[model samples]
Target: MTPIIVFSVITGYFGLLMLISYLTSRKSDNDTFFTGNRKSPWYLVAYGMVGASLSGVTFISVPGEVANTGWTYLQFVLGNIVGYVIIAFVLIPLFYKLNLISIYEYLKDRFGLKSYRTGASFFLISQTIGASFRLFLAAIVLQIAFFDSFGIPFWVTVLVTISLIWLYTFRGGIKTIVWTDTIQTTFLLLAVTISIIVILSQLNLSFDDAIKLVTTSPKSKLFEWDWLSDRNFFKTFTAGIFITIAMNGLDQNVMQKNLTCKNVKDAQKNILWFSITFLISTLLFLILGVLLYQYALANNIPIPERTDDLYPLLALNYFGLLVGIVFLLGIIAAAFSSADSALTALTTSFCIDILNIRKTKTVQKKTRLYVHIGFTMLMFLVIIVFNSFNDASVVSAVFKVAGFTYGPILGLYSFGLITRKKVKDKLVPLICIIAPILSIILNYNSEKWFNGFKFGFEILIVNAILTMLGLWLITIKPKTSLN
Candidate 1:
């Protein structure tokens, strides 16, 4: 894998994405950009979402994490199935009934104007951070493989990465993403499948032998019954459910695609199918992780200090030229599938939720185009900032941040749906801010305060609970109607 070959593969891949954009964006308007004219096929949305849901973080980080955590992450994946079920039955119907362009609009109907803005603001902040961190992972890989040889700086890599996403996404928006993601998902799965085959060949293991190796390895341990450990099955499983509810059900990035379907039924079908496929995809990644570690051990290769680097290190240095190319393609596809959608969702939230762009239809198109460009720059800058300070595993870092930021959203939506009491709208923002802060304090001191209990993804559940409590304390009963 010369730098030239890596660059060429990326160039060809990006060209395909731009071609899709050109085809879908023609005669596109605000309706198409935001909702895909509400005519997207249910099955395509299901397929594309598999790519978006996995993102670059899952592509590289999840497999790498398998060495340390083993199959405990699957507990969280099972929880995701429960969460997706809730989204399909509970959240989808609400968004559909409201005919929402931005899912946050439900806050306005349920609470008030301030609560609406508060929810949208939280989403903007959460998505910006989440998307930036994801792009940062991809940019690092690109810099190592392609740009460093050319003496390009990291910031330049960040700019080019985001700029490429903006180029394909600026016009077509969700309309284009629905189709492009399907293509990206195809490549992503192919890359993973091909890599598995190549690695099995290198190790001289047949398919049955490979399965036997992964299943019988110590890394195959999936259950943890220790109540005090963060990886405990109950804790991780519960956290996965809430994480999905908050990150997917309440997230504009994920829900925007779901909302593109023709109706509630189609959207539900998409969620159900996407959930099943996503689970299968995740199982494959975990299996690949087991194989990578096994191959390294048998070859007497020292594993990298960072688990996230294992796949890249082996593929580029030892797996020969073809595996190197497959690695690059898989990562690039995963990166764009996630980043492109995040950009669109950020722009959509800003225009609809922050600036009320829908109210000013005359200039909405121009305004949206500008906002899209602006967010692209913002993400580039955020990625640079993250690069300066980030040291932890990115997969852990992303879920940690999501726990804090998405907590208020989970709390807000739960309150609106489960209760009839009216809230003090002006104070909602303060409660949202306070809940995560309290969660941080508790998480930092969990061992002392709770008899050596460690928090994992379940921290998200705590944060949401605190937010719900805050909201509850501020609630007032609805006034009785006079007869």
Candidate 2:
């Protein structure tokens, strides 16, 4: 629990990551960095993705949220199961058939050059914001447990930790991450498993008793039949489906891992198996949440005002040494698993989609290195900005931002796939921009204007619909060709 122990654990973990980077990336090139030479194992990719998908937000925020919202988040996970199936069956085949390096390349083939860039640009923006939020959570925990003891500032902690991520990821890129994620995912799962065992032992509760304690507690309340609440079952389940489609199916970072699989069948297999394992991991975290609150109450520990702080506070100060060590490792693994992938995916997007260097061998490697460093710095700044203004739970904040940023992408993919109509390509960017702004406006006024209707994460669905409408307005008639 001391600063020295926390710092040492991080140091040792980072050293192991660097070693993995060295082993996996020794023979790496631009091809390996971008797509892992299309040779990653389906099973490992599926398992590691469990860690990347959860990230620091889920590690810190989800359990804390239980006291407030209970098992309502489980509805969203059920919807994610539905979404992941759609990705495996519907989206993966399209990417594979097109032979896409950047999935946004589908936009260019389906629509036009401008539409492609719009899609890629939105991904760049969305991934950066989302990645920053994850890293910000990790950085805050590190600052409190380690740096604060030495009077170090938050920015310095971010810079140093992010530098460590950049050091490991810049060379091997996604190739290293695939292997590294497997290991990190192990640590992440272990953290949860160990916490559950420790809490159960401390409370003298067996497996059956723990289940009863959770179910019998008022905090375990799941469904909200009320139509207007943000966390209502209908809204969350529906929102989870769309959010996964947009955030995972449409996201370059998440899809990048899937694309690394050897072929279409492998990628689909990876996603299918990942959904099953991911559901198990999520349930474990929710169970841990219940145990954490119970532990706090029985021992006369005062809960922190912010749900995000509860796990860290209890583990570091109250839950004793072993849980504390595992907690730090788990959070670090969760944050870096996603952040490292995001950094690689962003660099890949810029070099391939924005710069059109996917075909050019010359200067591509050098250019990629520069872009990698540039995104690292950009994420550092974004984390600082988020730390300044983030008042809501990090999980809610991530999805709220995703609604506005990722919505246009969902619309673009839907428009191109479901309909053959082409749009005035030049207007695509304007439509993407306007859709999110309008969603924000509608969200602000919904209670009054919609007769006390509160928008949940369903705002993402509305934003995507508005974008599709805009695209339809700009559609040009498909020219009929005689066979």
C-alpha lDDT score of every prediction, in listed order: 0.92, 0.92
User: Can you write out model 2's per-residue Cα lDDT over 1-483, one digit (the tens) per residue?
Assistant: 888899799999999999999999997899899999999999999999999998998899989999999989999999999999999999999999888778899999888999999999999999999999999999989999999999999999999989999999998999999999998899999989998998999899998999899889877888888887898899999999999999999998999989999999999999999999999998888888988999999999999989999988887787779989998999999989989999999999999999898667575788999999999999999999988878889999999999999999999999888998889999999999999999999999999998888999989999999999999999998788999
**Counted clashes in each candidate structure:** 0, 0
Pick the lDDT winner: 2
Model 1 Cα lDDT, one tens digit per residue, 1-483:
799999899999999999999999999988899999999999999999998999888888998998889999999999999999999999999899999999999999988988999999998889999988888888888998999999999999989888999999999999999999998898779878888998999989998999899999989889999999999999999999999999999999999999999999999999999999999999999998999898899999999898888888888888888888888888888889988999999999999989998777385788999999999999888898999998888999999999999999999999899888788999999999999999999989999999999999989888888988999999887778999
Error of 1 at 349 (Å): 0.7
Show model 1 residue runs off by greater than 4 Å.
480-483
Kindly state the number of residue pairs that clash in model 1.
0
As for candidate 1, its clashing pairs are none
lDDT of 2: 0.92
